[model samples]
Target: MKKCRSLCMLFFVSFSLWNCEPDHKKYNLETSALLALTSTTSVPPGSSFKLPDANQTICYDTSGVTRACIGTGEDGEFTNTPAPFLLQIQDSGETILEESSELTWQRCPFGMVWTGSTCIGSSLNVYWQVANAYCNSLTTAGRNWRLPTAREASLLADHSQNTFLPNTYFPNGQGAGGWTSTPAVGFFGRYLVSSGGNVTPIDETTNFPFRCVSGPKAPNASFTDIGDGTIEEANTGLLIKKCAYGQADDSSCTGSASPLNWQQALDYCNNLNFASRTDWRLPSIRESYFISEPSIGNSNLPISIFPNSSQAAISWTGTTYNSTLSTAHAQMVYQMYVYSKTDSANVRARCVAGP
Candidate 1:
């Protein structure tokens, strides 16, 4: 009985030892799962794996902490101050021409020659063709010069101050008349007029004084078709009506343009509503001149863009001469002239807006 009891105790001790042994398969699976979790997860605060945003540059601190450098200033610098860029042009002692228009004037007219600083107007007047050829052959400041266009010449006159070719820039006592590159519709080869800002047409064969201009030729006025029956002049930023008043078609004023008296024209323009705008009004003489395409000759207006433009000899302008309350100015663009007329006289109206 003692031996059997001892054997039973030994058997129970062996069973307990077997149960305490580790399972190698389960241990390997748990170890692999822990390694995967560590590999997929983000690195800790001081780890090298961390990165900055795509637009940012990485910056390092003295203490070995990584940081992002952002914004306009130099990387890692707090202040965002920027430096300004400037353009400077060298100046010569000669008169500085207008940069925007790139135009410079000779000190004297054609007949009177420019003798450096001043001019002598006693020279004989030359024919219009000779005047043009002389200007074309002129070489000033290494630039090929040419005769001034009608519009360019007109710009020299300050109508507001009633001044023609201010004496400060142009030599005084020189001939006040010059030939323009613009040609008249009915009369001669090219137009000639007095220097007093008047557009009196003179025959091309007649001798006249002329001024030389040096710069880029005046470009054809650009137009933007708004597709809403309105055209915008890119040069002057003026929006023009696609059709003239009393014209039946926008493509062409196949019918005669309706003529309204000065007051009626003003009222008609003020009441006009087209292209989703209602602030239309009669164009000023300057604005009217802006749309005039003297280079195109026909009607002295841009017929391709302004299809409904009237072929009429004269059109009413918003400008009024204070000399007489009853008279207002009209632009005879075909003839390249402006004249005062009775307010009651019927004239065509073309609406315009913006400066």
Candidate 2:
């Protein structure tokens, strides 16, 4: 028994996921341990999940046409497939345990009931302000629920399909949209999961359906400027080059970046010897999230941290795009998308090192 507890502790610490006095139910120890072993990275299992998934199996070129993802150094070439998540459906399917994130979600939106097979009844579309109050009022499964943060809300998206939620995990669960707790930078209002799977700020008075989630706080990426041209993300031990490739780095990156094809981008990082370190490589799709605190808007990147990055920072990722539940995270407007590895139109490269 002691050995089992020790292993579980290691799993939680390795993934930085264990929460004290969790507001929801505890995870099944045996299952979590096995899941932790599924990771291919240095970190344990929970970190390998391909959150906010993408689905661009067919690569596109600068002219916006479909092609294959072979020699193009595109996302489809490098993205590692994530293993399946073990969903622990509980409370007679009213509650769902997303074991990978350790977040329990209400299967149906507000005003709907899980009728064993699917959610029945029309969902309530509430304003941004009411989202929190409504979620807080819930006593579902004896856990304190709240509106999910932007990051948490992103995790719910399955970009592999056009639908918001796959019917398998969430049957007939589609609503107009859902509200996130992230306040927009300006007065646009709160963020919402649009029908297209992107999170954009909408007017405060706008109504959108919402679901409740109960979990420990979501993991965030915090960075420290390394005096050199790189910043270290405290959470993932990833050191990121401040500027995208082709941009000169000094007191904030400047100069128009020279766009590289996907393959050349990969070569540039592998050959990079910047900051007296030669270990740099392109960031995987999941690793890209830990690079910098994402900007919900294009210009939100602080000049000190990511100067001159205000434009739609369409950058290349090491992860290849696949039309499965397991791939893609190219960032645009702080939202996730896929770029054809061969598309030289606008996508640039940002190199990273250390996990």
Candidate 3:
């Protein structure tokens, strides 16, 4: 009996020393299991978690005898404290991302021209029917269409930089009202005029200016080469065609193209399906000319189609003036004017795509 007691006492002392060792990495986990369970685990402050959650946030000191963090709604319940409290080291090493908001947007690459610090572009002013039809025609690069957001429209200001002007000069005092995706404050997302400078709420029937946007104009994309290629994945149903017949000039054919008429043109490009595409339509004047080459007289079309195309004769565009040419009164209608092969000639129609 005395020998057994001495052996038992010796075993206890040896076991205690083994567990008290500082270097735990060298210790076998199976053998260390015999040690205190609480000693190996850490708890942090400002960390919250549930049992199913394995992401342990070390935001607290998980040392010594701490409160028992267990049970459903007891002290162990995951609260506002971080488990294993410690300052979180950033893994991505980034705290901010490039903002997509209009305020942060400095330039527009697709159809917009720089005015001051803001980007400005032309838009069609028409009733709801014409407005929707017009928006359906805009195509940037290969993208068929996109209406500007309220914020995007409001971002355009006379004091801002990068805006479109009537003249080639960017800073020229030329601006147009644009389309807005934002609904009025008191109304739905409708009846508003966006000028990239101000958002004026109006009735849907009121004629207003509008602008077009390229599909998420990426950094790698070029403004001058807005429509230069085709898409590999055509989920939008319309393919991006870099043709010149629909553009103002050879220099401006970098946008999408759809062979269509004014009425069917919108449907053809925006809705697609020249044969089967669901998104197809005609491009707006600005969008159609994002890649427009300047011409003098009615000279947008190919010389073969309109033989009169010359330096003096500018080409005709699909977009028409709202008011008819008359010395007596003004009329409201979408009309296009440009050089024609004949004095009073109507040419074969073309189309473009939009988002």
**lDDT per residue (tens digit) for residues 168-210 in model 1:** 5555555335877765544445555555444555665566777
lDDT of 2 by residue, 136-161 (tens): 66677789888776666655654345
Residue 118 local lDDT, model 1: 57
- The candidate that achieves the highest lDDT relative to the unseen native structure: 2
Ranking by TM-score: 2, 1, 3
The TM-score that candidate 3 achieves is: 0.25
Residue 186, model 3: Cα distance from true site in angstroms: 3.7
Ten-residue stretch with the least lDDT total in model 3: 325-334
User: Could you tell which candidate, 1 or 2, scores higher by lDDT?
Assistant: 2
Worst 10 residues of 1 by lDDT: 79-88
What are the lDDT figures for the candidates, one per model? 0.51, 0.60, 0.29
**lDDT value for candidate 1?**
0.51
| lDDT by residue (tens digit), candidate 3, 1-355 | 4234323533554355446544323444454243212112122343221111111111111111223333211112222211121111111211111122111121232233443343445322443323333344533233444454433332233211224222222222445355544333232224243332333444444555554432232111012223333221121222333332344434433333323223333223334343334433333232222212111112323333222223112222233221211100000111123321122223333334433
In model 2, the runs with Cα more than 4 Å from the true position are 1-86, 160-164, 173-177, 259-298, 309-312, 316-330, 333-347
